[model samples]
Target chain A: MATVAAPGTQAYARPALLDWLTTVDHKKLGILYLYFTMFFFAVGGILALLVRTQLAVADSSFVSNNAYNQIFTMHASAMLFLFIIPVWAGFGNYLVPLQIGAADMAFPRINALSFWLLPPAGILMFAGFLVEGGSANAGWTAYSPLAQQSGSGMDLWIISVIILGVSSTIGAANFMVTMFRMRAPGMTMFRMPIFCWTMLVTAVLQLLATPVLAAALTMLFIDRNFGGAFFDPNTGGNAILWQNIFWFYSHPAVYIMILPGMGIISEIIPVFSRKPLFGYKAFVFATMAIGGLGFSVWAHHMFTTGAVLLPFFSFMTFLIGVPTGVKIFNWLGTMWRGSITFTTPMLFGIGFVSMFLIGGINGMFSAVVPIDFAIHDTYFVVAHIHYVLFGGSVMAVFGGFYYWFPKIWGRKLNETLGKWHFGLMLIGFNLAFFPMHLLGLDGMPRRIATYSESGWEALNFASTVGSFLIGVSMIPFLIAVVAAFMRPKDQPDDPWEANTLEWGTTSPPPVYNFDELPEVRSERPLFDRRHPDLAGGGH
Target chain B: MAAIESSPRHEEGMSNGMLGFILFLASEVMFFGGLFAAYFIARADAQEWPPVNLLTEEQIAAGVQLEMHVGLPAIATAILITSSIVIQWAEFQIKKGNQAGLIWGLFITLAMGVIFLAMQMYDYAQLDFGAGDTIYGTTFYTLTGFHGAHVFGGAVFILIVLLRALGGQFSAQRHEAVRACSIYWHFVDVVWIALFTILYIVPE
Candidate 1:
C-alpha cells in the first residue's frame, strides 16, 4: 500500500531473489505466472503420457484402474486449472501493460495476489496424490454422487479450485480495470492491440462465469462435508444440477482458455504477414460475440443427458462458429498477397489457424443432436477437445512465447530449434489426437483403463505413439529456451518491424515500460512512427 | 521496485479503483448468483421444497422443525441496513472533512455489524433444523450462512477503515479505502436483503 502511492527510488535496492518475492511489478509477476503454469504443463504432459501408455494395448495391465483414473483426472485438472486457464494470465499480465502502454496493471498488489494464489492452489490440488485415496479421481468434471464418494483428496481438490477461482475472479477484475483505465493516451478501445482486446474479453468471461463455478464447488463441498444434498437427487436434490452449473462455468471456461490464444495468433499473423490485422475491429467484436455466445452453448455438452433444450443449444452452438469463422477468414485475408515471413511464431500461428479449423469443424458435428448422441463419451469427443485445446491453445501459447521472447528477454529463441519444436509438436499433436476421431467412430470410449478385444487396438497404439512424439517434441523447445537465455540481450526494439506500442520501447522493456511513448495517431503508432512516409495512418 | 515509476493515471466517472471495486462487486454478485441459481433449481425440482420425508431418522427423531421464523432474521436484516447507512454516513463525513464524524460513524457501523452477526448466531442456535436435515435446511443455512460470513467480513473491513480514520489517513479528497469499504459493505447489505426475502419471507 505504501509503495503503490509513493514508490521510493531506493525501494528496488533489495537483493534480487527477495525483490522477486516481494515484487508487484506486472512484468515480474507475469514471468512468475509463466514459470508456474509451464511447470504444471510439464507435470500434466507427463501424466498424459502415462494415460497414453496405459491405453496403448487392449486389456494391458500397465496400471490398475484406480491409478489410471487418478492419472487422467489429475492430468485434466492440472492442464485446465493450472496451465491453460491461467497461462493466459501470464501472457496477459506482461503483454497487456506493454501493449496498452501502461506501466503496470491497475492494481499491482492485487495483481501480485493473483499470481501468488496459483502456486499454493496448484500444490494443494496435486497434494491429493500423497493422501491415502489418491487425488480427485472422479474426473475433472467431478460429477456429483461420484464427487461425493471420493476421499479427503477430493475435498482438497475442491478447496484448492475455489482458491484458484478466487485468484481468477480477482485477476479478472484487475485485467478489466487495467485495460479499461490504463491504456496509453489516444489508444481508444478499438485502437488497443488485438491481444489486449482478446484478453479484455477473456477477463470479462472470467469475471462473470468463474464465480458460478465457485458456487457449484461450494454446493458440492456442502454436499460432501456438511451432509447437504444439493446435487443428490436421491435425497431431494437433482443430479443434473451439477452438470447444469458446472458446464455453465466450464463451457465459458473453454473460451477463457482459447480466446487469449486467438488474440496471440491475431497479433502474430498480422505481424509476420507484414500487414495490420485484416479486420481489427471485426476481430474485437467477434471476440465479444464469441464470449456472448459461449454462455448459451453450455448445454451442448449435456445433450446426451436428456436434460437440455437440444435444438436451441444445437443452434446456439452453431451460431458461435459464425464469429469464429469470421476470425479465420480475417487471418487468411491478412496473409493473403502479403509479404509473408514464416518465422517460428508465424509458423505456429499458421498451425493454430489450420488446426483450429479442424477443431471447429469437428465441434459442429457434436453440436448436431444425433451425432452427439453417437459420440457423446467416445474418443471422438475427446479428439474434438484435444484439437481445440491442445492443437489450438497450446500452439498459440508457443507462438506467443517465440513471438515475444525477444521483447521479453532481449534475445530471440533460435528459429531453427523453434521450427523443430513447432513441426514435431504439430505432427505429434495431430497424430495423437486425430486417431481418436476414428477410434470414436469405431466405438472406443474415453476415460477407459483398458478394453477387451474391440478391434480398436491399432489406432489406440498409434495415438500412444503420437503422445510420446508430443513428449519428445518438448526437448527442442527446452533447448531453444536454454540457448536463448545463455546469450546476451542483443535484440532491438521493433525487431520484426512490429506495429504495436510495445515495440516503441526498448526490447526487454524497462521497469516503467516506456520513457517516451509515441503520439498515437492510429492503432499502429509505432508503425506510423517508423514509416514517416505512411504517417497518414488509417490502419 | 520503487525505481519503476507508476503510470500516469486518469479515470472519469469513477476512479479506476472504484470501478475496479465495482467490478469486483459484480463478480461477487455472480458468486451469489450461482448460489441463488442452485437454490431456485432445487426449489423448482422438489415436489415439496423441504422434502421433510427425505430427512434422516435421527433428524426426524430430533424434531428438526422445518419452518422459517422471520422475527430474528428481520431484526438482523434491519441491523445490516442501518449499518449500511452508518458506513455511508462515515464516508460522507470524510467527504465533508469531518474526521471525528467519520471515525464515530465507522465505530457505530462496526458495532452494528457485530450485532447483526451476533443475532444471526442466535438465530442459528435457536433454529430446530440443522444444515443436514433437509434441502430446506441446507439452502437456508447455505444462503444465510454465507451472508453472515460476509457480514463478518464487512465488520473487519469497517474495523480497518475505523483504524485508518483514527490514524488520520482519509479526508475530503483521499478516501479510496473508505469508499471501497463503503461499496463492499453496501453490496453485502444488498445481498443480505435478497437473501432475507428469499430465505425467510418467501413461503416454501
Candidate 2:
C-alpha cells in the first residue's frame, strides 16, 4: 500500500495558517466561529459591566452622560449583532451538516465569505467609539430623527448593519441550499432532527427579513448624508415611515434569535430525559407558527408611538404566546416521565425555560397598550429584553456549546469545572437581572447616565455585584474548555448516548463528515439503532 | 473509500447556476416590493403626483427631465424584452445540438444586451437631474439607477456565457451556465418592464 498522510496532515496540505484562513471544512469553521463569538462575548460582556457599574450608584459622576450613552449603545449593538447572532450561526456552522449527514454546505466558498464578513462588521461597529463624535447613541433600535441627528457615527452604524445584513443573507442562502439539496439519501425533510428544522425556518426568516432592513437603512443613509426626504419630516418625509420599515425587519429578527434557542432546548430536553420528543408534529408546527406570526406582530413594538393600529397589533402580539406556550409544555412533557440526567447542558436548558417564562410574561404585559405607555422607555423594558435575549437565547447557546463540545473536539469537558461554571452563571445571572424588575417598577428610567439619590441605589448596587459575578463565572468555563482541548484523546462516538445522526460518526468527524451515510429510518435513527426496543415506545 | 464511492453523474436535476439565479430573482422581487410600497403610500397621500398643473415653464425648460431620462430607456427596454425571446430560442437550440442556431441566437442576444447598457448610460448622462433636485427627481433617479446597475450585471453574465459558448465549453447535458444566464436575462427583462410602466408609462 502507498504511504498516506495522517488525517490532520492530509487536512492541511498547505501552510497551516493559510489553510485555516481559507478552510472550508465545517469543523474548522465551527472552531473559528467559537473563537470569534467568544471574543465578541468577552468584549460585549465588558461593556455590560461598565454599563452596570455606571448604574450602580445614583446620580454619581463615574462616567459622563455622553460616555454612558456610548456605553449602552455599543453594549446593545455588540451583544445583539456581534454576540448572539454570530453564536447561533457558529453553532449552525458546526452542527447542521453533521446532524443532517451531509458532507459539506452546498456553497462552501460562500460560507467562508459569509463568516469573514462578520469580523469586519464587528470592527466597523466598534470603530464608532474611536471616531470624533463617538458611537451611534440612538440605542440599538436607531430610530429616525434621533438616528438622523447622530452625525458620522450613525452613518458608520448604518454601514456596519448593512455589512452584517449581507453576511447573514449569504449565510442564510447557503443554509437553505444545503438543507434542501445536500441531505443524504433517506434523510427526508420530516425525518431530519428538530434542530435542523429550526435552522431551516430561521434561514427563511433571515433571507426574507434582512433585505427590508437593508432598504430601511439605505433610505436612512440617504436622508442623513444626501439630503433625501425618505424619513425626514421637515423635508416632507414622515418619521413614522422609519418605524414601519424598522419593525418590519426587527420583529422577525426577534425570531431569528429565539428560534435557534428553542431548537437547542428541543434537542436537549429529550436527550437528558431519555425519551422521544413529545408531540413532535406539534413542536414543528409551533416553530413554524411562531415564525409566521413573528412577521405580523412587528407593529406591537410601536404601541407607544401610536403610529400603528393598537388593538390589532396588541391582539396579534398576545396571540404569539399560544405557540410559545405550546413549546414550553412540549419541553415539560419531554421531562415528565424518564430517568432525567442533569448535565451542565441540561441545567442551562432548565435555566432557559424558567427565564424565558418570565420574559414571556413580562412581554405580555408590554402588549397591553396602557401598560406599554407606562413602561415603554423604562428599565422595565430593558429588563424584559435582557430576560429574553440574555436569559433565554444566551443561556441556550451556552447549553448548546456544552452539548456539542465532545463531538466537535473528540473529548469531553471536565464535568466538575462545568458544574462550577454553571452554578456561578445561574446564580449570577439571576442576581444581575432579577433586581431590575424591582428597580423598573420603582420608576428608574433606563438609558440615563445618572439617577436621583433614593431607593434605587441599593438594587442598582446588587445588580452591579451580580454583573461582576457573571463576569467571574466565565473563568471556570474557559478553563474547562481548554482542559478538554489539551487532553489529546478521542471520545467514544456517542459519548452522551445522543440520538442524532451527528453522533453516529466518529468524534471530531472526518473532513467530509460521514464516510458512509447512515440510512435514516426515523427522526432519531441513532437512538433507534442503539435501542431497538425503545424506538417506538411512548414516554 | 469504495463504500463512499460517488453516485453516477446523471444530468444535474436542477443546475446550481439556475437555482442561484432563481434565488437572486426572489430577492430582487422583495427589494423592489419595498420601493413599490413606498411609492404607493406616497402617492396615496397626495391629491396629485408631479403636480402637473404646478409645472412651470422654467421647470419644463428644466428640459423635460422625464423625457431626458426615460425616452432612450424605453427603447432599451424593448431591446431587452426581445433579447429574452432570442435567449430562450438559443436554449431550445442548445438542447437540439443545433450549433449554428445556438451561436446565432446567443450572438444577437449579447449584442442587444450591450446596446441596452450603452443606451441606459447615455440616458443617465443626458439627464440634467441630480439626486437632490426634488422628490420626483430623487425617486426617479434612485429607481432607474438601481435598474441600470442590474442591467450592467446581466450584461457581464451574458458576456461570460457567450465566451464559454464560443469555446464549446457547454454540452447539451452540461449547459447549466447557459440556462442560468437565460433565466437571469429574463428576470432583468421583467424588472425593466415593471420599471418602464411605473417610472415612465404611468402618469407620475
The DockQ values of the predictions, listed in order, are 0.69, 0.34
Cα error, candidate 2, residue A69 (Å): 2.2
Residue A175, model 1, lDDT = 96
- Scanning candidate 2 chain A in windows of ten residues, the lowest lDDT window is A1-10
Predicted structure with the largest lDDT when compared to the true one: 1
Instruction: Show model 2 residue runs off by greater than 4 Å.
Output: A1-12, A536-539, B1-12, B51-70, B126-128
Candidate No. with top TM-score: 1
Cα lDDT of model 1 by residue, A196-255, tens digit: 989999999999999999999999999999989788776678889999999999999999
lDDT (10s digit) by residue, model 1, range B1-204: 322432333225577888888998888899899889888988888787567767778777888788767898888888899989998998898888899999999999999999988888898899898888767778888998888888888889889888988999886767889989988999999998888887766776
TM-score of each: 0.96, 0.93
Query: In candidate 2, which residue pairs clash?
Result: none
